[model samples]
Target: MHSYSRLHHQSGHAAILFSLFIPVLFGIFTLGTDGARAIQDKARLLEAVEVASLAVAGQGSDNVDLAKQYLEYYFPAATIQDSDIQIKKINCEDNDRCQDNESRFFEYQVTAKISQPTWFPGNEAIIGFGDAYDVASRSVTRKYHSETVDVILVADFSASMYNRWNGGSKRKFLDLKDIIVVIADELDSFNGYMADKSLKNKLGIVGFDYYTSRYNNNTRYFYSHLICGSNEKECTKTNPGGSTNSVNYSATVRDIFNLNSIAHTPWQKREVTNISSFEDVLLTDDMASLKTKINSNSFNITSGSGSGTAFYAGLIRGAQMIYQQGENPRQLIIVLSDGEESNKNTTQKLIQAGLCKTIFDKLNSQQQSNGDNVKARIFAVGFDYNVNNNPQLADCVGAENVFQAQNRDDIKNKILELITEEIGHLAQ
Candidate 1:
């Protein structure tokens, strides 16, 4: 009985010891789990920050908000605030201490950070602050090298563009306007980053709805007053003789709703007008002028806005606007369209007469100013449709240079890539 009593006392002592040990064991398990979680959170945060940094790297300080958005998208569950992400444009001069980015190398750095909700104070925990994990990323992107590049935008701002885009309520013209703003900002920023500030890039625009194709041979030129205020007015004078110009897109698209075609006007063949007048701006470094002109009555949905998609007119006019100035200039011609040629004179006859390829080759034939003997690059974008719908785009720029954009956002992203990668590119 005494031995049994001793065993019971020992058992009580062991139970008391185990009760105390249990809290310590539980604490260790909690520490291990939270530590592992903190590490995992940091790893994810680092990846998110890296991708977010790349999105706005070299894009400029104007896009800091954009970086934050990307970070949130990539790491949605994390608790982050705008203050946690810091973005600064490190334009190094002789006096300032720049991190990672060396001004002599003509480069800049974009930095970003993310702090997860703290599980412990950062001082109290190595992996994280309470539950919070901290992660940061830095990216150094090379600035633009010096070059006098000219970008010409040949777009279709027709009645269709005046209609809703992608079946949404927003007009397509507004989207085009937004695109113009993007181009202007990019060009301005490109100039701002150039090593040789003296050589500023130039921009031009040729917004064509329809063109009067002139004939070298019989009925070769299709000219009619494509521009009328509201209804069809007789074109008293034209560059080529006898054809009709259309402002009515419905009649020409040949929908089952309206299968009828337009009436031919004989007076289109009577006289000649300067077709160059159709283009909006010439090759000029004045980006503000380009912006202002695009918003002017010419591009807006005015009473006289032309609705016909004259592919030949836009292509030829763009070529002429660039080449007419000098022998060879570093130029990029970007042609965009939402539809095919709506006229027979420009498509079936005028281009078939060899004028289409002739002008396309002329614009492309110019040698690069650097004496590399490279030709000008032409790129075409078909909005909300395949570029194959517009055969002239392929004929002008080649099948390889054509790209199709699904929507407005795609358009902006694609154009930004074009600006940064083509012609005067930022080196890696």
Candidate 2:
């Protein structure tokens, strides 16, 4: 009986020990799982805050309330009470305290915190103590207005331009609008002066197409009648609005849309009148209006691929415009098209036959000239069914200048990359 009682006592002690250890093991397991979840939540919140802050800074929103609203949209579950965001704009000169350039770079810092309640006895008790939980994440972006670019858009509105490029869902007309809106918005970034007094660049546009019915002056380039009003008078009695001589845009892109229009005259009377300057208008707005017009007019791609695709003709005209300015400014030609140049001789058999190749080769040689100091880089975007097959059109703007996109997103990204790279080059 004494031995049996001693054995029973040992067994009871062992059972008690196991019971104590069971809770400790279970507590540890639960803590690990819950801790992982808390960490994930914290990381997600930090990312959300960072993105929100960037959006606020990019939009140039001064109202704190709007920022808060934007934050909620990005992080639907995260409360502003749990996060702190601070924004600072430092001059490029003051960036490293070197005071080298006056460009402004905005820095945004976001700090977020959240607490999770513990349920286990030890952890639950510690919740009342100072040991809740904490995690951190960080991201940085630099913003500056360091350079200005005056762009001359040369769009291709030729007969062969009928294409369904955006995944067989969008026609050329629709896609062009999408491209314009994006480029214009990017161009608007040029404030010329940043918060830190850095210089932001400006953009200009020149869209071209066939509308070449009248050309009396036969001037290589003619100022838009839209700018100064009636061609008959220097300045019209009507408020001629803004001049379309230099249309401003924010982003870098190709010019396929030509705003050149023939004077509205009857076909019979056309011979009687001697035309001076056939106005090739593009845009007239300085800021938001330009952006709005691009968005509005993009979808309105006119029918009838008139005259023909004057690929190099447009380039020559654009280059001349830059020359007429008399200032040695940085010039870039963005050619967005299918790259098929029409044989003008087919339409006018008696006209000069070899002009296209002659003109094209001259421009090509000039672009490749080693002594040319003017920064003129051309970016040719092609939507060819087979990129390798279409060498002439794609190669017009130079090999380095060519960019082929598969979709709208790809096109947008490539354009942004090109513009950013050019800006970096200018900074140097």
Candidate 3:
């Protein structure tokens, strides 16, 4: 009877231990499953905040309300608390907020938190912790700032650019001219809004054409400089409240460099030709000079000569000018091409595209000795010419960034999107 009683006592102890372990084991199971699910939800929450930050920064200053909308659109499953989101605008002068030199102008800061019920029984039975888990994230983006930027327009002056017979009704060069002015105006306006005028974004122009050698080697021809006869005046430009007046003088077909005389004639009695190859103007903030380079009569005189780019030289030339500035300001290389006939082979075209990409990679991803990829973004525009069999261009500058505008109106709209979405986008 004593032995039986001892066994019953041991059995009672085992039953109590088993009951205690059941809740502890139950907590462990819930922690493993629900904890992992919470981690995944946290990641989704972070993605929502990141995307919303960019959209709010790019769109405007409406703030937390706008960000919530973006969050709902991007992450509908997230459960947000009323007090869990914050958006703030930062000014560089406020050293407390804009501590880093990179955030030198205006900034948009976004913060978000996701809260959901916790399935872990430990919260109620043992730990007395809250019945929910909070997953939170934050993102900061720059808006207009005091950043100095240099914009280079790498334009195509190929003979094809002078034609209208291919699906296009207007001369491609003229259409390109309208596009150039629009871009310049947008950039200038960006500069105008800057609190510091010295931080003006500069503009530079490059006109490129393909040149073939006697050995059949083809190279890009850059309009390096412009000149005028001792007696003739510079071409007048068409601007607001400005009337244009020009004297008709003989046009000359000089050698590629204008070093040797080839032929002389007059086209509708326009300005004298002192244009030559390899005379690209460096970056400048002067609008009149930029307009003159585009409006000059010789600028439009594209006869049956010149077809030189493997597609990268113009970009390289433009980038070189930016490097010369020494300010390490933000840089943008705007490539303009109808299409190139010289790069006829698919492999050949992609090779040229690779060279262009290398230059772009270098220019956009400039690094300090410590290896901070300045994290700059680049955009490219592709206007449709009569013969744009050069779809290879989409590969040149990411397909999304390339705007294949069919008409003048489309060109303006594309420019608007480029300015709005990507130009000053410094988000990482």
Q: For this target, which candidate reaches the highest TM-score against the unseen true structure?
A: 1
Model 2 C-alpha lDDT per residue in residues 261-296, reported as the tens digit of each score: 321211221322212112233332264655554555
Runs in model 1 lying further than 4 Å from the true structure: 1-8, 40-44, 58-142, 145-148, 164-182, 185-189, 212-277, 288-301, 304-306, 319-330, 340-377, 380-417, 423-428
Per-model clash counts, in order, read: 17, 22, 11
Q: For model 2, where is the 10-residue window of minimal lDDT?
A: 247-256
Error of 2 at 4 (Å): 6.8
Better candidate number, 1 or 3, judged by lDDT = 1
Candidate 3 lDDT tens digits, 1-428? 99999999999999999998877777777777778878887787778877887776675343576688877775565577557889876655654554445334457778888766666536455442246777788888776554556667777666667666343456777777777777677666566556656667677776655321111124322222111243433323111001232222132111112322221111121221212232355687776677776666535635544333333435545555665552435566667776563434522333353544555665666764566454334455655633346655556666665666666656665554444443355554
Task: Point out the higher-scoring one by lDDT: 2 or 3.
Answer: 3
lDDT of 1 by residue, 250-306 (tens): 222221111121222322322443222223577776777777766664456442233
**Higher TM-score: candidate 1 or 2?**
1
- TM-scores, one per candidate: 0.58, 0.46, 0.48
Q: Which window of 10 residues has the lowest lDDT sum in candidate 3?
A: 263-272
Which rank order by TM-score, best down to worst? Answer: 1, 3, 2
Among these predicted structures, which one has the highest lDDT? 1
